[model samples]
Each structure stands twice: as C-alpha cells, then as structure tokens.
Target chain A: MKNHFRLGLFIFITPVLLWLLLLIIVPHVELLLMSLHGKDDMGRTVWTLANYRNFFTEEIYWYTFVRTALYAVIVTILTFLVTFPVAFYITKIVSPRLSGFLTVLLLMPFWVSELVRVYGWMILLRESGVINHLLTSAGLLDAPVEMLYNDITMLMGLVYTSMLFMVVPLISSLEGMDDSLIEAAHDLGASPMTIFYRIIIPYAAPGITSGSIVVFMLALGNYLTPKLMGGKNSLWFTEQIYNEFIASFNWNQGAAFGFLLLALSSLIIWAGLKISKQQLGKALS
Target chain B: MAPVLDIQHLRKTFGDFIAVDTLNFQVEDGSFFSILGPSGCGKTTLLRMIAGFQQPTEGKLLIRGRDMSRVPPNRRPVNLVFQNLALFPMMNVRENIAFGLKRQGVGAPEISRRVDSLLERVHLSGYGNKDISQLSGGQKQRVAIARSLVLEPSLLLLDEPLGALDLKLREQMKIELKKLQADVGTTFMYITHDQSEALVMSDRVAVMHNGRFEQIDTPRNLYSNPATRFVAGFVGETNILPVRASSSAPLQVQTSFGLMLRATPVGNCQSDTLDLFIRPESIILTPAESHEDINLFPLTVQNILFDGSNTKLLATVGQSDHELLVALPQNQQFAHIGKGDTVPAGVHVDSCRCYPRGGS
Candidate 1:
C-alpha cells in the first residue's frame, strides 16, 4: 500500500518537476554561465568579469537601475494605498451581491491582453488623445496638454496594470477578518483611525506583503507600459536588458543585467519581509 | 440608584423583516442582566443597539440619563466582550488590556499601571507579555473582559462571550464571569442563547422570543412563574399539557387527555384553552394507599432515565395513556423504582401554573 501511494505521488509530481527543471532551472543556469563569459579577440567565448563590471562603470546604467527600483517602490506603495480601501469596502462594507459584482468589475480589464491595455492607456493619455481633446473642449485647458511620456504616466500605467494583483490578496485576507474585531475596537473606545491602524492593518499584513511583492516585481520588470507611455525618457531596467539582448546583440551583457534585476528584486523582497516582520511563506499563503 | 442603561421602545428592522421590536428595559447599576433566547430571537440585535453599534428605527437609548441616539459606539460609554472574544492577535496580553486606555490618551505610566492591575484582577498577573494565541479558552475570555472593564465604561456588554468554550470550560467560566462582574461592579448587559449560562450567571434574565421579551425576572421566578408558554418551554425542563378550564374557581383545568388536573391560574387566564406547566420535580410519588387530599393519579412507569441527580421517570397517567415526566430525587426510598412499576404520583395545585394558550 505504501509503495503504491509513493508511486502515485511520484506520478502526480513528475510533470511539474520536469517542467521546472527544463524550462526554468536549465535556462537560468545557462544564463549564469553566459553572464560570466565574454567574446575573445578571435570571437571565441572565454570566462571574464567584464560584463558584470560594465554595469557598475556605466553611470547611465546604474542611474537607470536605481530609477527603476525607486519607481517600482513608489508604485507598490501607491497600489497598496489605493487597493487597501477598495478591498476593505468590498469585503466588509458592501452587500454580498454588490461585492461579487465589484470583484468581477476589477477582473474585467484583465480579460484583454496587457499589451492591448497599455495601448488603450496611451490613447487616453497622449497629447492628441481623448482626454486632452475633452479637456480642451470643456474649457479646462486652453490647449492640448502633454499627459503622456513622463514619470507620472509611466507610474500610472504601472499602478493600473498591477491593481488586480494587489486587490485579490487584500480581499482574501480582509474577508477572513471578523467584523466583531472592528466593533470590539470601537467599543473599547478606539476611534475609527485607531481601529484601522491597530486591528485592520495588522490583520492584513500578510496580504499587504504579498501584494506589494507582486506589484513591485511586475513594475520593476515591466517593459511594455513604460516603453509606450514614457516614450524616450522611459529607461526601465527591463528595457535596458531588452536593448542589450535584441538591439545590441550582447547576450553576455543582457544575461548579467537579468541576474542583477533578479538579485535586486530578491534583495528588496527580503528587506520588505524583514521590515514588516512577515514570513514569506505565510504572506504567499 | 438610577439605571446605567435604559432602552425605550427600541426597534430594528431590515426592509420588511423586524429584527428587534420595541425592546424597553433598564439595566441597573452593578447588576448582571442577561437577555436569554434561542438564536435569531432579536437578543443580539437588542444588545447591539445598547452598545451603540446599530441605530434603533424608533425610540431612544439613555446611558446615565443622557440620550445616546446620536452617539456612536466609540463615543458611547460602553464596551462589548464579543462572542468570539475578539482579542487583538497582534498585541500581547498587556497591550490588549491597555489598548482602550491608550486610545483615551492616558499617560504611559498610567496605562501600564492600569493594565497591570487589571491583569491581576483577572488572575493573569504574570501573563502580561504572553501572546494572545498562547492563552487557553478561559484565559482569553478573562483577557477580553479585562480589556473592556479596564475602560471603566458605564456598562459592559457581553455578547455570548462563553459560547465558544467547551462544555466543561463553559461551566467553569460561568462562575468566573459572575465573580468577575461582582469584583468589577460594572453593569453588564449580557446576551446569550444558552439558558443554563443565563440562569446560572445573571442576577436577572429576560427570556426573549420572536423579537420581543416574553418575561424578565429572577431565574427562580422565571422558572416558577413564567408568563408565557415560550418562557415555560425555553427556561427549564417542564411538561406542558394542553388543558381547558372547567370553571374559574381559583384553579381547575381539565387535561385534553381526559384527565382532570388542578393548577394555579397565572395572570388574566380567563381563556378556555390553556397551557399547564408542571415541573417534573414537583410531582411526589408515594405508595398507592398513602395519597390523600392532593391530586393523585396512578401511573405505570414506562422508562427510567438515570442521570445522576437529575434522574427522571417517564410514566403513563392512570389508564388515560397521557405521558408524564416525574423527577426521581436522590433518595434510598426510590432506589428500586424501575420500568413497569405502578405507583401513585401526587401533584399539588400550587406547584402547577396555567397560562392562557397563545394569548399575549
């Protein structure tokens, strides 16, 4: 019986293990090898640290890396601030039917491709777009104002694209909270703000960590939104990696940048876990 | 002394369904008052209104002679120990107790002092640093009570706080809660669906049914002199027999089972059809030839339910086939009483109460 159980378990898990090993682990190992090598004078690949050193020596590369990290952090914080109340309202305040409807509304935008969605934002945000036309016609602006190709536009696109990821975790966590806890806080003479801080925030910490991690990773590695919205000034880290691999045909340099981006995301997530005092396992669950 | 919490004609309705209907009551200062009912009987709705969590559709709630119609829960001088004992999981025992004081903007030293003293009062002196999850069910219950009582609210509302505990723990906490209420001397408005908890813990209990209070009295009076059929059935174990008054001569009721019985009429029981409530323990079983003066009937015992001190004898009255429950007291004389034993059971007229059937 035990042997049969073991065979069944192994059979059930073999496909996932094979997929992970072949598709993810193997490629990452290949990239790691490629990142540590450079083309020699005769065009033969040889081991070197020059590819890794190039990132630190180039001022624009380092600046773009820091800018992307900072932008991702800002977007994560903004998404949290915007999504927490929306999640709370849906889970606790609204009727069940309305809450279900609102959840579907949040999910509706994800049905279309992320590329299509970013392009849609471009239409509404560009200088000659629908928003500018409406503003000028309504006498809100004398001329069409340039609303696209800026940091704000890039951040807006990042936040909008990553909203559903943040909200899902938050709603699941907030819905598990008993309403009586809020009432108990109120009864104990805690004001609304105190209740939110002392009870709701602490109870939803795992959800916050999980949501922030997802949003930050997506925003940091995002290529399409920043490319379409920020135009020339959008020097996101992923865009730099894309340029190294596709534009410049520097596979070794691109592989190094990919590892660096991976390291940066891991470091930030680790710091976030430390600061919030939440375990990654619990947060993900 | 004036009442601490006075609710007059308070009602709560959702669309067409009424949750609470014109609930009027006053909880005395330093008294443990419980609203006891089955689930969805509007007791919780009434308690929420008292705690200022929900607004009454009509009528006013007064706390310490001040109208609290506009007061929100946080502003009201009341705190609730939730049914689940909703202790803040993020805080330690001391922090949980000190939460209300901190919210009140009390000094740091004062907050610690009060938290320490409250912990001592709840018999959890050294558990200040212990996480909430580490505490057992009863300890958590005390911490919840301590958290609320530390606020020194005019009234403390306990919403079935012991409902989640196991049977043994629930029994233990009943006495603990009553003692805690006495030690704190805070007026408590407790709502629970458990009849035993209400009867054992509260100074007075209001039996509620169908969005209204059927009777509000001391536990003994409620058991002995219930005003409604719902109360008699809900409060304690009693045999309710359908009967009709032969005549209003102080007390005389004819049972529907073709047996004439005697009872003390309750309230304005002028109606012909009535409900006769006879406590099982009130019936006296004796040798066949020794019964005289009192209402006696020969019964054949069909079943003997032995439950320690609460044993009961189920029997058929005379030859009428009407089932009657008679409490078997713990005594040497009735030790041999078993199934199929024919004995004479005597029921005193005053031991039985008759209420007008389905009458308000």
Candidate 2:
C-alpha cells in the first residue's frame, strides 16, 4: 500500500520534474557540453580544449570575471544600505496609511521592465540629459556634464533595479520581529544604538542574508545595465560572452565565458550557504 | 515605609475608547501587588503605564518619590518579564541573563558571577549554555525570571508570566515565584485576569472593571469587605440579591427571601434600591424543625452536583425570581435532602454586605 502511494506521489510530481529537466537542467548540460566542444568554420561541432586554454592564458578575460564579481558585491552592499532603512521606516516608523502609500510608490517603478528602468537612468545621467541640463543652467558647469557611459552609472542602474528584492524580504523579516524584544532590551538599559546593533540587526539577520543573496545573484547575471550604461569602455564578462557569440561568432569562447560566470556564481552561493548554516547553527544552539 | 510606586488619576484613551480611566493606587516597597480583571479591563494597560511603555493621557506616576511620567522604559529603574517571555532567541541562557548586566557596563567577571548566581537561584544552574528553545515551558519561565532579576531592578513588572503554563506547572510556579520574590526583595507588579492566581501570589490586589480600578485592598479585605458590587461579585462567587431599603430600620434591607437583612451599607446612597451580597458558603442549610432565626427561608432543593471536594446545590426559596446556587462540603450530611425536599436556608446577616445598585 505504501509503495503504491509513493508511486502515486511520483506520478503526480513527474510533470514539474520533467519541465525543470527540460528547461533548466538540459540547457546547463548543453552549455557544459559546448564549453568542452570546439566549433568549425561553418559552425559545425568539433572536440577541442583550445578555448578553455586561451581563456586561462588571457589576463583580460580573468580581469573581466573578477571585475563583474566585484561589481555584484558592491551593488549588493549598496542595495542593503539603502533598502534596510526604508524597509524599517515602512514597517516600524510610518503610519499604516502613509506606509501603504509609500509602499505603492516604491513598487510603482518595479512595474516597468528592468530594461526601461535602465533607460530611465541613462536619460538622467546622459551628457545632454536633465542632470546635465540643470547643472549647465545653474552655471555649475560650463558644458553638459559627462555623467553616463561609465562604471558608476552601470553600478547605479544595477543597485536601483535590484533594490525592491532586498526591501521586500527585509520588511517581512523585520515586521515578523517582536516589538517586545526591543522594549526588553531598552528596559535592560541599552541605548538606542546598542539596541539596533545587538538586538534589531541580529533579529533581522535572516532577511538580510536572503536579500543580499538575491541582489548579488541578480546583479552578477545582469548584462543590459553594463552594456547600456558603460557602453564601449565597459568590459563585463557577460559582454565578453556576447562579443564571442554574436560579434565574433566564436561559440566555443562564448561557452567558456558562460561556464566561468556559472562557476563564479555557484562558488558565491556555496559560500553564502556555508556562512548561513554556521550562523543558523549558532542562532539555534 | 513610603510607597515605592504611586499612580494618581491615571487615564489612557485610544481615540474615543478609554483603556484605563482614573486609576489611583500606591504600591508599597518589597510587596507583591496585583492588578486583577477580565481581559479588556485595562489591567495590562495599567501595568504597561507603570513600566513606562505607555503614557497616560492624564495622571502623575511617581516611582520611588520621583515623577516618572515622561521617563522612558529604559531609563526607569524597572524591568518587565513579558507575557511571552520574549527571551533573546539567538542568545544562550547565560547570555540572556548577562544581557542587562552587559548593558550597564558591568565587568566580565561580575557579569559571569551574576549570571551563574541567577541560574542557581532560578534552579537551572547547569543549563546556562542551553538554547532557549531547548528548555521546557517551566524552564523558560525560570530563564525569564533570571534575566529580569539579574538586572536588580528596584521594581519588576510581570504580565501574566506563568499564564502559558499547564495548570500543574502554573501552581508550582506560583510558589516558586513567591519564594524567589522573598529572596530578592524586589517589588513585583503582576497583572492577571485569573483571580485565584492573583489571590495566591499578591500581598494586595486592585480589581479593575471597564477601564477603572474598582477597589484596592488586601485579598482578605477585598473578599470579605468589598467596596463595590463588581468587586464583591468578581473576587469570588457571591450570591447577589436585589433589595430595597425599608423605612422601618436603619441598615436594614428588604430582600425577596421574605426577611429584613441587617447589613452594613456600602458608600452613601439616599435611594431605597440596593444589592445585598452573600457568599454561597455563608448560607447554612438546616432542617425545617431546627430553623433558628427570622433570617431563615423555606426552600426546595432543585439540583445537587458532586464537584470534587464539595456538592453544589441549586435551591429555590419559595416563589423567588432567582434560584440560590449554594455549595456544601462533601463530608457534611444535609438532612437526607435530595431534589424536591423542603429545607430551611439560614443566611448569616452579618456576613452579607449591602451596596448601592450598580455602584461599581
């Protein structure tokens, strides 16, 4: 009877498993296969390790990989700094009516596509855009300020786009926290700053961790922001893959770049999980 | 000795609805004081105001002779054991106990000594490193006490601290709490809707109703000589009989039981309308032939129930509108009285109190 029940459960879950296998598992496996295989002049498949070897030997490729990882980390940190205070205000300080209005206002920008949001940043930061126009009119600048097509703009776009992800989880975790704990800490003679660092931060650690992980992953995989904002000077790893596949038509090189980004993201996720497990064990024990 | 904490005309209102109104009391030092009422009677609100968690709309609250109306909870020399305990889940038992000491900038060795001493005091010495979730309900209760007591706050507020425990555990904790309080000598302000818990644990209890304190007195005083109809009815079971003051005698009430009960009138009232209160245990069941006084009434036993230590009887006195719910000791034989048996019910007039109707 148990065997039959188990079989029934497996049958019920088979479709979802098949969808994952087809869309996610298969594509990743194909990417790995392509990374190992070489392409001929006519785009025919051939076996070779030349692309991987070339990638290891080149400084630019390794630099791009490191730079992208660094960009993602910076974006994650900046997003958290901005989002945590806002989430806290919404959850604790503001009146419910005002908070609900502010929540809708914060989420309004998210309704638009990430591509459009990036374009919005481009318009604001461009040489002849509103910021430059304001500066020039105010006589702060003799010419239109050259703000766009740089790493700063790219980082700004990534942070803005991924901010909502951080805020939602942070608000949820903070909202779930018992207010009595804070009051108890105060009754114990803790100052406001002490209460924040010792009690509030530790209580909301799970939200912080989960939010950072999401922001980091999203920022790392993003290609549009760097491409649009950084323009020709930008040397993001995703751009390198884009150049290899579409511009250069080098599928083998593109596959190698894809594999490297995948490996770096996986390493980060694994490290994050390890730290989370350690913190969780400490919290539980 | 001076009052440790004094609240005068304390009132709190949330928009149109009043939570606590015109509450006045003085808590003596080194004494356990309780605010007892049903839920929504503002007992917890009163405690919260005392702890500086809530500000009264109108009142003066003084702690140790200093006005603490504007003082915040943290600055006050007081600690609260929250109803849920609210122990720091991330910290171990020792860490939780040491938290307050650390906040006060106590030295490491002193913090350790205090934590260990508190753990032993609460009878959980070896469980210092255990996680909060690992401890049972009773253990959690002890940890909460240890954490609050370690701070050595002059005043400690407990909001139904043992309310979550099972009956047996709650009973045990009441005794443990009293012993702990005796050892520590901290004035504890406890809040509970459970009258028995309040009666067992407090040196004095203030009964609250409809957001105001009805009366404040010792348990025995409040039970035996309640100032209001609500207090008399709420503290324990009381049989309230509607009465009309007769012009024939001063302090004499005409009850429906066909007798003029000579009872002490509560408060000043010129009207004849009053409510006379008699405890169920105060009414004596006797044989009709043995009836002794004019206060005796002939009644028929309508029902009898065996309630563990006692048998509760439902008796009707003549053609009265209300039936009497009387409790008799299980061992006491009652003249072979069963359902439909005639009996004489003697109410001790001295034990009955007369109060103005609805003066609560």
Candidate 3:
C-alpha cells in the first residue's frame, strides 16, 4: 500500500519536474551556451572568450554591476527599517481582524503590474505633479521642483513596491512566535528595546532572510524602475543586458552579463545561507 | 506573616465574555497555592492578571498589601515560568538564568556568581552552556525554575509548568517544586488541570469552576470534604447520590444502593434536595452471606478488575440499573472475589458529605 501511494505521488510530480527542467534548466543552459559564443556584425553567433574577458577587464562594466548591487543593498535596508515595525504592530499588537484587513490593504497595490505602479509613482513625482504643486502652493518652494528622474526616485519605487513582501513574511514569522516568549522576557525584567533586539529580532530572522533575499533579487534585476524614474544617465546593469541583447544585438555579451548577475546572486544566496546556518546553529547550541 | 498576595474581586472581561468573575483570594506568605481547573476556567487569565500581563476590568490585585492593579508586568516584583518553559532558545542555560539579573543591571561578576549559584541550586551544575532544546523535559523544567527563582521575586506564577511532563517525571518535579518553594521562602501560585498534581504539591488549592472559585482549601480538605458537587466530582472518585432531607437528623436517599441513608447534615444549609457524596474507597464491599449489622445492600457483581494494589468491583445495586463502583484492597480479603458474585455494600454515613442538590 505504501509503495502504491509512493508511486502515485511520483506520477503526479513527474509533469511538474519536467516543466521545471524545460522552462528553467533549459533556458539557463541556452544562456550559458550563448555566453560562450562571440557576436558578429550581422548578430550571428561565433565561438570566443571576448565577452567574458570584457566583463572581467572593463571598469565601466564592473562599476555598473557594483552600483546596481549597492542600490539593492540600500533598498533592502530601507525596506527592513520601514516594514519591521509595521509587521510587529500587525502581528503582535493589533487585533487579528484588524491585522488581516491591514495586510490586505498593504497587498492591494500588488494587484497592479510593476510597470503600471512605477508609472503611477512617476506621475506623482514629476515636476508638475501633486507633490511639487503642493510644495509650491504651500510656499515650501518657489517653483515646480525636480525630484523624479534620479537615483532617489528609483530607490523610492524599489522600496515602496517591495515593502509588502517584506511585511507578509515578517508578520507570519513574528506571529508564529509564542506571545509567552515576550512575556517571559518581560517577567525577567528586560526592557522593551532589549527584548526587541535580543529575543524578537532573532525569533524573526528566518522571515527577515526570506524577505531580504526576495527584495534583493528583485531590486538587483530591476531595470524598469530606474529606466522610468532614474532616466537615461543612471545606467543600471540589467539595462546594459537589455541593450546588449536587443539594441546592440550582442547575444554573447548579454549572456555573459546575465551569467555574472546569476553568479553574484548565487554568491549572495550562499553567503545568506551560510550566515543563517551559523546564527541558527549558535541559537540551537 | 500576613498574606503576601491579596486579590480582591478581581474580574476580567473581554467584550461580553467574562474571563474571571469577581475572584477574591489571599496567599499567605511562603505558601504553595494552586488554582486547579479545566481549560478556559479563567485560571490562566486570573494568573495573568496577578502577573500584570493582564489588567482586570474591575477590582484590585494587591502584592504585599500594595494595590498593583495598574502596575505593568515588568514593574511588578513577580516572575512567571511559562508553560512552554520559554527559555530563550538563543541563549544557553547560564545566559537564560542570568537574563533576569542582567535586566536588573547587576554587574557581570555578580551575575556570573548568582547564575552559578542558581545552577547549583537547581542541581544543574556544569550545564551552564547547554542549549534549551537539548535539555530533557525535566531538565528544561529545572532550568525554568532556576531562571524564575534567580530573580528572587516575591511571588512566582507557574502556568501548568508540569503539564507536559510524563507521569513519573511530573510526580518527581512536584516534590522538587514544593522543596524549591520551601527553600526559596517565596509565594508560588500554580495553575494546572491535573487534580493529583494540585493535591500533591499545593499548600492550598482553589478549585475553579466556570469563572468562579468553587472552593479553596488544603489537599486533604479538598479530597475528604469537597464543598460542592463540582469539587467532589472533579478531584477524585465520588458517587453523588440523589437524596432528600427526610428530617434534620436522617436523610431519606432512595439510592440505587438501597434505603434512605441515616446521615446527618454536614453544614447548616437548609435545603430539601440533598446530594450524598461517597468516595469509592470509603465503602466496604463484602459477600452477602458474611456481612451482618452493616448498612448493607445486596449487589450482583457485574465486573471484577484487579488493578495491582486494589480490586475494582462494578455491580448493580438493588433493582436500579445504577452501577456502584466499589474499590477493595487487593489482598486476601478480595482474592476470591470474581465476576457474577453477589456482594453486600456498606456505606459509613458519618463519612458522607451531604450538600444541597443542584446548588451550583
């Protein structure tokens, strides 16, 4: 009976495994193959190591990559600062029904596509938009101000769009924790701030890791936000990949760029897992 | 000493649902008091109110005669060992024990000294760096106790602290807890659904039913003289026979055990319908032919069970379909008794407690 059940489960999972191989694994392999092939004038594929060499040697390529990574790091930090208190409030302080309603309100923006959401932010942040209009009318500014089409606007979009993802996991992890632990801490005479840093933060680490990884990955790959809000001169790396593949028609360079991004993300993920394991091991010990 | 804890009319309500209804009690200094009840009987809510995690809707909680109804849990000089032990999983045994001292801003050397002393006190010497999850159930329990006691709080509240332990371990810990209380000379207010656990360790037990305290007394009083039907049925084996007050002297109880029991009123309560409570062990079971001059009723034994030290006899008394559970010593007296045997059951009326029926 157990064998039959196992067989049935395997049969059900086979198609999904096949789909993952075809969609995810196959595309990754094709990218690796294209990265090994050099580009021609007619955009034909020719075998060479020039694309990889350029990625390693060029300071501009490295600069854009480093810049993109730093932006993601900043966004991750901002998201952490903004979302943690909100998650804590909803999970630990508020009534369940109210928390549920607030969570839904937070997630309501997710119903719209990222493209539309960025455009919406662009509309509000433009020089002639409501913010500048309000500022000028309130005598806070002499004329329409320039805030959009900069690094600040790009960062704002990234942080705002990813806030809910951070909150949802954090709330779950925080809520899953026993309320008695906090009471226990208080009973031991720990202050609220001490309790938050010592007990609550560590308890919610898994959620923090998950939320950060997701937000970091999205922020790292994001080209649209910077393009729409940061404008032409900012030059994020994912935009470089887009230009290489479509505008410049350099498949090998684009593939190389994509591979490097993958390697960087993988390294970060490995570091994250290592840190999580070490901390978790210490907690366990 | 006067009572270290005095809670008067402590009521807590959530919206329309009353969690605790006008609970009034006092804990004499350096005593083990237990609140014994089923789940949702407001025992935990009452404990939380005392701990200051919860504020009662009405009434006052006094610690050492100081009204602490509005005092926060952190400010209150009381500690609680949560049911799950709630040892900081991140910290080792020594760190967890030192947490309270650390919060009080004790110097590191003093903290180490105190933690080491407490570790020894709880018989956990050299387990300073042991992980919480790595400890056994009983060890965790000891760790929790050590952690709570290290603060030297005037009062300690334990919420079913032994509810998760195995039977033998629970029994062992019960003795250890009572000893710890005696050694520390602090008030312990414990909560548990286990009646035996309550009776074994508590200096006084308040039996809670619904949202009210049914009775508060010592273990002996609770078992030998339960004030209400709820208390009688909850604590131990009890046969509550429906009876009537024939007069003031002899109660007329048409029990399945036969005849009006010649019993006197236990208290001054004037009520017609009475409930005669009899513990199974209190009754004498003998063969019908050998019994003489006893308050005897002929019962046909339906089932006989040998339970190591005692023999349990399930029998039909008189013509009623009611079955009386008779416990007999598993010695030579009941060695020959088996199923389908007829026996005479006798009750010592003096030992019975008569209460007004349905007086809850």
Q: Of the candidates shown, which would achieve the greatest lDDT relative to the real structure?
A: 1
Candidate 2, residues A126-187: lDDT per residue as tens digits?
88898998989999999987788888888888899899999988888888888889888888
**lDDT at B317, model 1:** 85
Q: lDDT of model 1 at residue B174?
A: 91
Looking at model 3, the pairs that clash are none
DockQ, model 3, C-alpha based: 0.69
**Candidate 1 stretches greater than 4 Å from native:** A1-5, A40-44, A136-143, B287-293
Give per-residue CA lDDT, model 2, range B237-337, as digits (tens): 88888988885235777887666666777776467898888888887777344433336677788888767776778888877657888888567587377
Once superposed on the true structure, which residue ranges of model 2 sit more than 4 Å away at CA?
A1-4, A38-49, A95-104, A131-143, A273-285, B8-24, B256-260, B287-294
Q: What is the C-alpha DockQ of each candidate?
A: 0.85, 0.79, 0.69
Off by over 4 Å in 3: A1-63, A95-105, A128-146, A245-285, B250-252, B256-258, B286-294
Best by TM-score: 1
lDDT of 1 by residue, B121-195 (tens): 989999999999999999999999999999998999899998899999999989988998898899888899999
lDDT, candidate 1, A1-285, per-residue tens: 999999999999999999999999999999999999998899898999999999999999999999999999999999999999899999999998999999999999999999999999889988899999999999999999898899898899999999999999999999999988898898888889889889999999999989999999999989988898888987899999999999999999999999999999999999989998999999998
TM-score preference between candidates 2 and 3, better one: 2
Return the lDDT, model 3, position B349.
63
Query: Which of candidates 2 and 3 reaches a greater lDDT?
Result: 2
- Candidate 3 has an interface RMSD (Å) of 0.9
List TM-scores of chain B, every candidate: 0.95, 0.91, 0.92
